[model samples]
Target chain A: MDHKILQTARELIEEAGYPALTVDQVAVRAGVGKAAIYRRYASKAEMAFAATMHGQWPPPLTDAGSLYEDLLALARAFHVRMATPTARQVAPALISELAGNPDLDAQFQNTFLAAEHAALAEIIERAVGRGELAGPIDPTIAHLLLLGSLAAGLYIINLTVDDTMITELATAAAAGIAALADRHHSGNPQGATQPQ
Target chain B: MDHKILQTARELIEEAGYPALTVDQVAVRAGVGKAAIYRRYASKAEMAFAATMHGQWPPPLTDAGSLYEDLLALARAFHVRMATPTARQVAPALISELAGNPDLDAQFQNTFLAAEHAALAEIIERAVGRGELAGPIDPTIAHLLLLGSLAAGLYIINLTVDDTMITELATAAAAGIAALADRHHSGNPQGATQPQ
Candidate 1:
């Protein structure tokens, strides 16, 4: 029942701006009573966070021995996540909310930011442990590069409901990120740190 | 004179959204007569496109010997260009307009889209000429990854507005792109194109 409410809330927010969502509207959409929502979330922040995490943040990248392979897969998954029409309708509002709300900001930092960094970090640790990457490369910097590419791929269609371009964007990003990881693994003087 | 009006119009739009800008407001901003704006841009699109180009596309990347070096310079230039706080305020509205207006979209394609691609292509050409990249890496794909990372970096910072994080984000993107390009140059056979 709570899961149904969350999905309904996400749909309402996705259709209307985040600022415009009402618990009443969410309940109506979910076909549940308002009390059900209050039981779960005290305020819109919790509701929106639930909705956003539901909407954003594709799952973690598994640690395939080939870091490039893993990173590329993550990119593909990221694109698939964004391919939803709701992503287009709500992206602008999401940007505004993320920019303005400290609570949401912290939530994002904890959930999306930390998760993304962790996935990339896992790949790096594996590579470094196996002597795949050079000593000079920093995992933090590598994670930033890989995750940055994935994030960029998300907005390629930007607010356009049309997602036909996502596959190309994802494929390119995954390949590019993977290629970089592979090169760094092959003893490049500098890996995705400061351009050669 | 008309060109000057169009340019001024964009600044006005950036300062105040398109809905807010009046012919008189544009004239005042541009230091031109209202008739001049009327003379050139029958509507807002004519004017907004020019102002956006001011920062949308910086000058093209001149061929520096190596793709990495050329892109480093280009990426940094882009960082400074989008760093304008005002761009964030105005970008979404303009992008929103793109969906509704074909003329504006074409202008965007010509100005912002074409210039970035042209510049990236130049870098790729240099790499190919130098035999730095292997037989064939789709230039379009390479272009998207590089631009996507750069775009994503700015969009994330702008949306998140975490001023402290930009430098690291920018650095990571540049490094990642360089690594990606290097792999394109080297051509790895273990590439995973599509996943089941």
Candidate 2:
């Protein structure tokens, strides 16, 4: 079944790494014919993408009615995703491997990065609609600020991202976005927080 | 002699990555005996660490007398270090390799992460002294915000980190820090900017 193959693939990725994941090995583990897998996916990249999409993808965020709460939701969701054993094991390797494998890179961007960007963009748009933000903020930059801070704490510094850290990061990010929107909308820094 | 060995090691890392870099290859490229490299460094990781330290370390930041300017200097400095061809080539691999390699992780923390943390800490301390900040802010959180934003912009998005982005990130970080400190000092959000 499709579910069995995806589950088996996820286990293989968690146990070894993406480089060690192969179609034959996955088929053998899943007790499915290699032909069945090939029928579903064109390559290892596609299979891994499908497995990841099915297994560990974060659910889409709903608006929390406040920019701070909305950013917190997204940040917490990202933390949950990155904190997965599979994600922790696979992500660094995937990033390294992506340099040489353009196909994998494109697949990751299309499936993961693009979706993440869209979700964050929606959050920012909702904030703007509620007049919490001055106007549409650059979601890419917003994404960088929110997720980037979490990445540094989790990946670079090897810190445990507890509730306190998440709250602080989310609050600061919301403040930063507000300040940026203020600066962008009005050239003068003083007019940043005033009514439009 | 030492310079040549380090240069060769850097070239190897840039060309074929750290796994392919061996002391023997470094000696051959640098026209030094294998024993010479062994005499200088006990392991390939040590040699790579030294080469990175000698080659592309960011300069220590002097206070520019303002939090915004100081952070901008640090952020810009970080951008320059990351933008190097060798850094672009080796960083992702290095991050992946660090998980399995304790010695490399230690060296990275001691030499690079610690120094960057100290520099940002100094900037925050200076800001406090000038009353630009209410009091000392958490340097770890501050460093995460600044470098995290840069890393996201550079590594993940694969976007060029221009001066504008750097400035905005720095300003937002400063504001974030102020907001955090205010929240820490006073439970209420309204008193954050009013007093300091």
Candidate 3:
């Protein structure tokens, strides 16, 4: 029943939009009673939220063992998702809607953004503890800049719902992060590559 | 005349919505003849496009000498616009309506996405041509990752507005990019730097 509701909600959002969305319409479309819909979801907003996330295809996250590999994992997941057209379409509307509705904003945060940050930050924090990063480095800023470069990857490359987009973003992002860390650690640009 | 018309259109949009937008209301609010508006714009949709974009703040691009610095400039400008409470109020509705309407869609894409991407792509293209980046990098995916990462940053960081948001994003982005480059070219896990 929950799956039915989610599937129905996804169809509605893909066809129409958030403003035009209605719970009664969802119930009818799902072949369920209004009471059934209400019993599962408190409101159309709730249902919409679930439906929006229904078909998310997160890329394979590889454990490269090194901090760079870990970071690359995050970037790769982002690249694959951004490159996929289906994911690209409705996901943006969610962000645009973030400023208006606190619940939706919170949902996006709790479910997605915070987790990725935590994963990356934890890796960096561990590196700091191990004296891998410089003593003066800020974990907060590290997360910010790391994520920022990933953002830059989007504007520089056009994600046309294809594999080339994926490889290009992933490789470039990997290159960009490697360059940044090398600079941060060693004053010498040439010193960026030490024997692993 | 354009200013007055835009201000009035904004008021109407805020008070009502995209659904309620009409030239008749804009004329009455601006104390201008409807013919005056039609003289400049082909339709109400066009007028609405201008009104909504009246405050659109695209990135202030610059050749910061390096990919990292250039990326920072873009993020900082975007941050300024998004940091204001106005970003919260105006951008949400504007994006919503733009996504919903094809006419407004053209305006939004041209003014915001296309222009910004052009600025960012110039930097990436320069890097690729210079052989700093590997050949055949997809500019599209790169842009999406950049923008999507920023969108992701807003939720993850415990910040208030777009400036802090973009600033953080830019720095982390630089770091990530630098890190990736280091891994690919130098085999260094840390201490990568750019050749000045």
Candidate 4:
């Protein structure tokens, strides 16, 4: 029953686009009562996310034995997930809704973004453990770079995210993050203190 | 009359958000007929952009005598423009619409994005002339880093784009682009040819 509703929702979004989707249509098409649909999902945004995005989120981070390789794996996974026909179609609508709807935004942050952050945190931790980094650096800029660059390429410039492009972007982001971490550590005398 | 219409459009978007804005409302609020509004602007999206973004774009790109300084200036200008209340409210809607609407998307690419690309080209040209870079690097990566990072920070992470943050982002982007350019040149023997 849940699967049927989600699949129906996905089809509707793919066919008519997200802005045109509604609970009434989903209820009718899925052959479920409105009460049943509402029982499972609180709103159209929630249902849309569940159907389009919630299934394959955070995209599995693996230990590739090096910072660059790890980042490459992460980038490759992200690109694959983002490049899907369903994801591409729904992204703009979801992003726009996220900007305006605080409840849905919070849900996304807590569930989707939080999981991705945890995955990244593990990768960064591994890098630190491997002596690749001096210490844990803030991942904010790195996160922005990876997600932002991919979004820009996919949505704005219509650039195809091929393997070569993904590798180059991952390389740039890895280098940028390392440089930033190096600069931050070196710039502050207090933070620069190392055990003798 | 144009000023009144634009001002009214800006007010409506800011007050009610972009999703709720209508051409009819703008016409009524501005004390003009629908035909008058249509005469000046072809669509609601066009009117919204004119009210919010068209006024202060592509943001001035000043040559600060060096690649880092120039990038910093550009980043700063972009941050200021994007941080405005009007811009913040309208951006998600505009971006969402751009994805779905071909005419508006084409106009945006031809006018706004084209201007930004031209400005960035000049910066890269000056960097090359100054011997700061080997050759022209694809601005695609650099552009993604700049604009994508900013959008992510603003819309997703709710980051505060301060001077220090802006400087760090610029520094990272400059270093990243330089490294990519260096690699591209060194890797390509044909492109690496220099006039004796």
Candidate 5:
């Protein structure tokens, strides 16, 4: 039923990309009637959204005791998540498709991007709580550095996102955050506010 | 006439996306015959690639005296290059299309990615020559951090790639590279190798 349709949709996206995914094709592939899919999703976009939601989402962030460990753990988890065969195929398609479609983009943000942002924000917040990170850390920028570096390595440079790459990225991100915190503290002592 | 056809192709991509940019439509829009376009480009991909290459690429890297200034300059330049209306539309489409099309991917690498990598590598080389960076700085990683962070900020988070964002990214990247260099130097005194 629902699980079978979703799995079939994921496979379709992996094999032929997002554009090739059609409601009819998904129904045919899943051996279900079109009416069944239409009952669950109104359109191809909805089907893709539902399929992505049903697919692998990054796991909940765990407290790794230290900021370095937390970032490393997060990076490693994200690397593994993005390294999946489905993710490798689906993510680029989604990113491109979402860029043009605002409604889909909003749905993606609400469903996926926001959760990822929150996970990274939590890691930064915990570091601040432990007094390991200084006040006024921009979690968005930190997340961007961490995940963006990984994305570039994986997508742009065509590098294998292995343990070594993840470790290096996490370490560099930690150092970058510390440096920014120090600069902010020294430059704007009174403006520095603790992470909420 | 060639320029006009290329411009029309770019407009087609911007308006209707890459898939919609067909030789027939481009000929109609550019007020040129199909044979005229065919004389230059064998297919739509070739036309799109030519148009992109004919359009703005990021400027060559310039020495800005200090590593921080050099990186900041490079980041700002890249930000401007990516912030173009055409770039905003075409880049994501190209990325998605290129992932599946190995011939286009190879052309993209040979035409664009390799040049960018070399430019960043040259910048890092100059920094090492001046003793600004330690031995064994990985330019590929450095380029990934800088451009990847920029791409995430621009594309993913939907953040405006403004001056403040560029400055912050460049600063963080500079710090990250410096930290990595120090760690590399300390941990692998004998094993440290220059950027390949």
Candidate 6:
């Protein structure tokens, strides 16, 4: 029953858009009563966010050994999730909506952004443990390089981050992180790559 | 006259939002006739895009000698433009609106994206000529790294891309580009930094 409502919501979002979606329309199409939807979701925005992002939460973190492979895995997972009709069409509009509403933005940061940040922290930690990264690079900055670039490529230019693009992006990001860590430790550019 | 109209439009967008902004309100505020606005802009979207982006268009690119300095200059310029009240508030919603409209998206690509791309191409060419890069890296990819990440950082998290952030990002991006070029030249990772 819950699956049916969520799927119906996804269909409506794909057909129309995040802005056009409403509780009434969702209730009607899902063949469920308004009470049913309200019981499941607090508001139209919540419903829309869930329908677009339900199964894709926590961002599919991987235990891949190296920073490059780990970032690649995360990037690929992000691409797969974002390439969905629902996510691609809905996310930009949803994010735009977030600009006006502080409550919604907080909700988003708490739910989606928090999870993704946690996943990234774990990846960075694993990389440090393996000596692949000299120490922890800023997770927020790291997140920007890896996932932020992928999101921008898709949202801004409609350019899909393909395997080649992903490989290049992940490699560059890993290299960038290494360089940053090196700079932080020694303060000299020349000593960036030497053994600690 | 055009400046007054654009400023009024920007103020309306900042106060209410992209959707709530009307040509009527802009005219009243600017103390100009409706005909005056229509003469300058085709529609409300155009006016808003222009008002939010009038002087910032063609993205201030610089030839600061090396790729790292050049990229840092570009990054700082982008930060200044996007950090404005109007651009920060309006851009996300405007981009969201672009999803449903093809002609508007094309206009955006032609007006903003194209100029930015051309500027980046010039920068990449300079890097190649100076032997800072082995060969030209993908301009689209480079744009994503330098500008896209900055956009995401601001739009998503409201985190301003400060000097510290820009410095770290520029360093990483430069390293990333070099690593990519090296990989392209020779398959071996060790050969990435050797004199060409």
Local error of candidate 2 at A88, Å? 1.4
Q: On residues A76-180, what C-alpha lDDT tens digit does candidate 4 reach at each position? A: 877877777566656766766777777777877888777777777777778778777666666666677666677766655555678877766776676666666
Using TM-score as the yardstick, the better of models 3 and 6 is 6
What DockQ do you compute for every candidate structure?
0.23, 0.42, 0.28, 0.35, 0.38, 0.50
TM-score of chain B of each: 0.67, 0.79, 0.61, 0.82, 0.77, 0.81
Name the best candidate (by lDDT). Answer: 6
lDDT of 6 by residue, A84-150 (tens): 7667667777767777777777877877888888888888889889887678888888888888888
Which tens-of-lDDT digit does each residue in B96-161 have in candidate 5?
666566776776677677777777788777877878777557776787778888876666555666
Error of 6 at B195 (Å): 21
Model 2 Cα lDDT, one tens digit per residue, A166-189:
888887788888888888775676
* Candidate 2 chain B minimal-lDDT segment of 10 residues: B187-196
Tell me how far the alpha carbon of residue A182 in candidate 5 is from the true structure, in angstroms, after superposition: 1.6
Q: What interface RMSD does each of the candidate structures achieve?
A: 5.4, 4.4, 7.1, 6.6, 6.1, 4.3
Alpha-carbon RMSD to native, per candidate: 6.2, 4.4, 6.9, 5.0, 5.2, 4.0
Q: For candidate 4, what is the TM-score?
A: 0.86
Best by DockQ: 6
Model 6 segments more than 4 A misplaced: A1-4, A14-20, A31-46, A187-196, B1-4, B11-20, B29-45, B54-56, B187-196
lDDT of 1 by residue, A1-196 (tens): 8779888877777677555778888888788888878776656656765666544565756676554456556655755665454443344345444544556656656776677667666765775575544432443444434445444434432323223334444334344344445444556635444344
**Model 1 misplacement above 4 A:** A1-4, A10-24, A30-61, A96-106, A135-144, A157-196, B1-24, B27-49, B52-56, B92-106, B159-188, B191-196
Residue lDDT tens for model 2, B57-169: 55867778677778888888888777665565456566556655566677678777878788888888887887766677677788888887787565544556788888788
lDDT of 1 by residue, B93-167 (tens): 454455345666666676677677677777766766776554434444444455555555444434432333344
lDDT computed for candidate 1:
0.55
Q: Output the better candidate (2/6) by DockQ.
A: 6
Candidate 2: regions farther than 4 A off? A13-24, A32-56, A187-196, B11-23, B32-56, B187-196
Per-residue accuracy of model 5 over A9-107 as CA lDDT, tens digit each: 988888887667788999998999999998876567567756764245658777988777888888887777676555555566665666677777777
lDDT of each: 0.55, 0.73, 0.55, 0.73, 0.71, 0.77
